[model samples]
Target: MRRPQLLHLGGRPRQHAEREPRHRRFCRSSVALTVGLLLTGCAGGVEPGDAASPGPAALPEGVAVEIVQLRADVAVRQAQVHIVNGSDADLEIGDVAVDDPRFVAPATRVLPGRTSRVPAGGEVDIRVQLPDVACARDDVEPSEPTVALGFTVDGAAGTARVTADDPLGFLAPLHERECRAAALAEAATLAFTGFMPAPTGEPARLELTVTPTGGGSATLVAVQATNLLDFGPATVDGAFPLDVTVAPDDIAPIVVDIPILPSRCDPHAVQEDKRGTIFDVRLTLAGDPGEIELFVGDALRGDILTWVSSWCGFAGTP
Candidate 1:
């Protein structure tokens, strides 16, 4: 075999007598070559023109979108959307599309067609009209609706779909108001005909003509009182533990006795002259398990309080 060469530290050639073994020389050379190849591969993998490629688009930063109002009438569903552009650049908002088909672009003058440009670090409000089907149904859980907002950031177009997490609790209040109105309307069918004040040592009376909607004989099970001014429960005697029955379609006059209790007339309580101090009389009918609440208008509440004051010997106290 031919003699193997040894490399000196300073590029000096070693003589045959001082040369390393052939296998050792070969191993050293292979290692050096492998390391060189690795460095070359890494350098070649990166494209020279990659610097020209556009950088990743910046997402909407510090942006806030909320549902300010969600209203549903008998015919149309409406939503007032509020958007705040917290980004550094002005955002051009384009057409807004909702995932639900029931929501459509609002046609109201308050919120005209799209192309709303929100200034940097500013807020904008837009109204979106929805179909009647989009209204919250009693059977379904209240879910915050989402909309896909088409916007351009930094002059580059993009779409950001956002869901309105109701921070204001708007849906619950709306539903409650609607339900209360419906209950009041249903109770109106049982026309209130008269109000009778009791004589000395007797309780005051309210006469209501009960006409069952189903045209079947119904019984009054219980009656609860609520104060309209405070939205709290009120007191009523001869209303609960009720066992009064009425014939169908015939004017079955029912009377509820008003008590002369301290709760009905408080001398220290603020007495306002408006109709706000009314009572909501909730009547529980036999056939319907739900209570039908009827409002005693301002005029009626005033009259009732006056009668109660006279009976309690505190007349003209206010």
Candidate 2:
């Protein structure tokens, strides 16, 4: 017998080749599993409840915000926030969040999904709603409450602070009324000195010193005088020139001369102190065209009329 036809099949053994295939398959499976895990991670494997990461750095330039109007009724309180885009590029407002505990809004209306487009050099108004209780508290003084606004300008996130002017008037009716009254009171202070005869024989003159009392200046526009009895014009309707400017806490002297005509006077009644003469003077201020009732005291009125009567040669009973 060919003692042993025990010849090797090839240079390598079959057992080693079979084991090599198994090893390669195991390695491929392991690599696929690892790559699958990594891809899943990249494609939002994070939980839904996870907090959002911080946004990109820097905010778009030339964006401004201001509180234009605030209104409050029994049901809701709302503020109109005016946003101005001063830059040349259009702005996409992603969302606006007022970091005030008093404010509240529906999540659907706040941000991310709700967006506003503002063209360059244009402006937009956004409404911010708050609880009515927030406006219920009284504000004793003029307070400019600063509010923080968190919003995105052209996809860039930023925070800004705005100073609101007199937003507390919604609290109480008396609050606004008192504020207006105080402002009107502080607008000016008037003093009536004695009257004197004018150099012009037909008219009598009086001196008035007007002083501005508040933090602002006042421009005296015009003054009108009317008789209390018949509402007749006591002085020429447009005779006095009142283009006077009074600085804050400064005084300006004005002289008013009126024609002392006896056509509307009752000499007998004037003789009797019972039917005294009264005149109502109205002072008009520039910018605020509303007439401010100027005080002409009873004594001052009597003095003015007495001088007029003497100048007109009617100083006797009818």
lDDT of 1 by residue, 1-318 (tens): 000111112112232233335224333333343343333322222123435543213235555555544212211234445555555787776656444322223223234454777776555555555432333345555555555565667766655455543444644454444454344333335544466676645655655555444344545555554331221123335343445555555553455443323234453342432222223344443445445334454355566666656655664633
Cα lDDT tens digits, model 2, 87-133, are 57766554454433222222112113455666765555555543322
- The TM-score between candidate 2 and the true structure equals 0.33
Local error of candidate 2 at residue 103 (angstroms): 34
Residue pairs that clash (backbone atoms under 3 angstroms), model 2: none
* Shift in Å, residue 272, candidate 2: 7.5
Query: Runs in model 2 with CA error above 4 Å?
Result: 1-184, 198-201, 228-239, 249-263, 268-286, 315-318
Highest-scoring model, TM-score:
1
